[model samples]
Target: MAFDEGLLGQEAILSLFEAARWAASASNGQPWRFVWSQRDGSELHKRLVACLKPGNDVWAPKAPLLILTVTRTTRERDGAPHPWALYDLGLAMGNLTAQASSMGLLVHNMAGFFPEKAKELFSLPADHEPVTMVAVGRLGDPEGLPEKLRARELAERTRKPLSEIFLGQSP
Candidate 1:
């Protein structure tokens, strides 16, 4: 799932999962979970794709896969509270994004998806909360995006200097 393989095909989906399997978790609880959909005759894909905010809708249409990542409130191996479950999920997503990038596929993590609607739509277990949605696809020409989004398309192109992010001092 390289960055170029935007919205993964069948093979890339398998690879992404393989990469996610190695994500570090709190006490090895492995609370991170995913419900995936490919824009291949999946009824859920219709609603899921429609759920993206207007800005995302423009570029999301190019994605081949949509993933909903969830976190479990309880540990799988023990009954302890999964305090770092969300953080663990983040780590998994990070790995997924990097893997996708390495594979030449593009991965977009979107927060604007309808989380509440997703919960009811997927019928997720009571303890599992759908936290975020990710769009997997190959990077397309930015020209295809709406004018408004085009300007911000590469907004995150550069990371802020480390000095501004962390300095052992208050802002």
Candidate 2:
């Protein structure tokens, strides 16, 4: 049960990626790569569809699109292993998610995907590290969600208090 759902048009999708392309990275090492899939009937699509966890499988189909994010750690710029590559990729993803939200599209980041299955399904290289999957769709009716999700739909999903998360001098 998302807050809202309005799928982006092709032009909007391009714009969203264009915005993501500019996110700042550690040492300017842009390590993010995205592979997008729509709910089209195809062998690859079916394989990816099968990789989702059962809980996600329920509402994910209602999403307009899916993005498989990966990070490239060893770049010519760094040459050494970039432990922060994944973090940098997250930053870019944050940018993408925010931009999509601003555009009236809802994004659900799912961690329930099977990475091994994703690697095989997408034919990823040995060096390419697959991260999470993102589901973007028009926000459907929460009431339409299954009983479990509906029960949790309006549950107080709260962020940790700043006092707990921040460990610095009080401003």
lDDT, each prediction: 0.77, 0.79
TM-score of 2: 0.89
Candidate 2 residue runs with Cα over 4 Å from true position: 2-7
State the lDDT at 51 in candidate 1: 66
lDDT of 1 by residue, 132-169 (tens): 88888776677656677777875667878877888676
Question: What's the CA RMSD for each of the models?
Answer: 3.3, 2.2
Residue 12: error of model 2 in Å?
A: 1.5
Clashing residue pairs in candidate 2 (N, C-alpha, C atoms within 3 angstroms)? 4-139, 5-138, 5-139, 6-138
- Clash counts per candidate, in order, are 17, 4
Could you say which candidate leads in lDDT? Answer: 2
